[model samples]
Target: MSETYHIPVLRDACLEGLNIRPDGTYVDVTFGGGGHSKALLERLDNKGRLYAFDQDAAAAEQAQKLATYPQFQFIQANFRYIGKFLRLHGVRQVDGILADLGVSSHQFDTAERGFSIRADAPLDMRMDTAAPLTAAEVLRTYSEAELHRILGMYGEVRNAKTLANALVRARQQAPIATVAQLKAVLEKHAPKHREFKYFAQVFQALRIVVNEEMGVLEEFLGQCASLIRPGGRLVVLSYHSLEDRPVKNLIQKGVLFGEPEKDVYGNFYKPFEALHRKPIEADETELAANPRARSAKLRVAVRTEDGVR
Candidate 1:
């Protein structure tokens, strides 16, 4: 894998969170540039097995470099189906699972992928290139209310309703098929000095919806409790609150949303125990080295014996 493909954020911290065992089986669900997987292989002996997944074709190409390692295997699919894919390989349970969520640097840098607000490319932000939905399609087909909800919930955009109306109005005149066209529509509604941030928020919302990111994350998290062996680790590095909230809730409450279910004994039936009371943030050194790490939050949890089915 080319170093420029991605610089793994909080590399050491993530490895520590995984608490890797030399001969144990592991999975890196977001094998973006294989930076994390490569590092993981270095710590494992021949008996250690690592299964990595990525839907991006570019990432699959990077995974090819690690193909020579007998301990490493790459699956070209979304991590939402982690359990099913692992099961297909006869891996009923694993010792550790590491998820590094959000867009990779390579995606953003490659303007044609349309993940960056800085670029003026076709509004195609599907993480899995083969997926039917794209940012432009979402803008074209979604109802104003649907757009409003996604913007407000996913992007947390303050003027989501107003912006949604603007998009509806603008699209009537011309198709908002590219980043430049979308920005033109947004510029009129964006806060004066915060236009860039506003654009990012809008873009983020579109990307999330286009890729069904939150839904995918929820499914993957739900599977984690069952797919990991007791005492195994679940280490997730989430870039935004939308991604982090469910992870935090699952580790602390054992449910993605709302209150945890109670047993007959009146104790909550939680599957995992958090390793740290608070999620770990990038240190100043790492932040300095990779500005993208600024928003990264690392949370680690260990599967408990209590809820084993």
Candidate 2:
């Protein structure tokens, strides 16, 4: 019932990074809490428009509660399908694109959402409630081998195999329904001193798979160069290495495919130009204010027309 603690990460930096124009069109790919979208709208003029997408129904409701802005339009859909969603509204070009990826504070603090390992709630980490695969279903249905791969590849858990085998074995005795039950299985496999961070990774890995985040990010970034008008900026705030690594690689080297290629002329031929060589880390001020921002890594890129290949 109280105000959610979304506290947009890199607020000033994101806005400045986008180089917001008074009458330009913009898109907030992840409109969690509508904090960034509202901020963007406030900076826009009557002619300006901001089209924000959030798959979560709760987030769309949050956007509805905001002070009415004529220039704001909220869409309830995944950003990966952004190309189709924007096209329906007859939108072709945007001045800037912003995405604040990963689970939000509201999702974590709210027990029913079951995102945080700290709380005991139903293992339903779907950002969009309509999403068919819930965390509980994943744990309850997945093979031990499949579970191990996700935990290892996504969460970077050290003993993923042990953890996966334990999950499947434990759930067989009783279906894993809540975060507490799942943690009980993972706790035995987790290290003694590093239990919290360790378990958090396990949960993070499950959440990422349930949401298909890596695939979603890939689709969203693939369209960015074409979506944004030339010279328009792309600002992203990724919370973990899994998310940041792709962003870093894409910004430095346009294509999200395999490794970069070398040419006879020695031209790198990257599609995007990095606004900053290094990722922007949260300052002590921001970290102290919101510990969630501690892991936030922001990368900005500008669209280039040169790399058509």
Candidate 3:
């Protein structure tokens, strides 16, 4: 098997934000390559516990070489069911939660995964390879209107209408199969830049759909409110502005779904304490080392007695 390198982004920031307790329980909700988990484990004593969740089984293969430790447990499941997975492990609340959201370098670099537009892979962009839906299925099955809306909203492509129409017309002639095939069909729809922001957005949208990313994130965030202990930190790194916007609003306002409420004492009851008003970005050094950190926006919040402030 080929070794896949999964570089954890904002490593220092995430570790600092976690404020890890040596003997405290922690959860790595998106344990892509065990980068953060290894760091967390190194800080913990034998008594300290760490649980990791990843729907993709392939994501866990990297850390199999670690010495057997009772304190560390890796679960093969979606982070969306964090609550359920933790329950099975006999865990109720955790001291910290780390979520590194976005496609892992391993996934993008692997041609078979169909995440990178540069690779001539199949149109199967499921982060969790076991996931039922693939990009090809969506492209071939979804109505042109649905495709247009996905590109417009999720991808934020300016020429979504033209692109969707092109895709629809192309599919009628021949079913889209590989990345290069799809690229060829939509070449006219993309901007002057071939491998720049234009195609990135389009690929992002397809990955989001294949993985059901936004929905999973919403579910996972809501679970964090209940899964984290008071004072436990919730740290997330989102790559897309669309993904970061919701996290920012949810962390600061503490109200994700409904209007905010205030008690008679004029003190609002919030579930979490927003660590910073704005999301943090990668520093110059980290960015230079890893261009993936360029789009990273890190958000940190502490769980409060009441939901996120």
TM-score of each: 0.98, 0.95, 0.94
lDDT of 2 by residue, 1-309 (tens): 123558888988999999999999999999888888888988999999999999998887788865488898889899999989889999988999999999888888888999988878999999999989999999989999999999999999999998888888898799999988988887788899999999889888999999999999998988887788888899999999989988888888776767778687766667788898798989999899888999999999988877643
Higher-lDDT candidate among 2 and 3?
2
Order of quality (lDDT): 1, 2, 3
Give one digit per residue, the lDDT tens place, for model 3 in 251-288. Answer: 76665656568767666657777788778898899888
When sorted by TM-score, best at the front, the candidate numbers are 1, 2, 3
- Ten contiguous residues minimizing lDDT sum, candidate 3: 1-10
Q: List lDDT for all candidates, in order.
A: 0.94, 0.89, 0.84
Poorest 10 consecutive residues of model 2 by lDDT?
1-10
Per-residue CA lDDT of candidate 1, range 56-76, in tens? 999999999998999999999
User: Which regions of candidate 1 fall more than 4 Å away from where they truly are?
Assistant: none
Better of 1 and 3 by lDDT: 1
Q: How many clashes show up in model 3? A: 8
Worst 10 residues of 1 by lDDT: 260-269
**Which number leads on lDDT?**
1
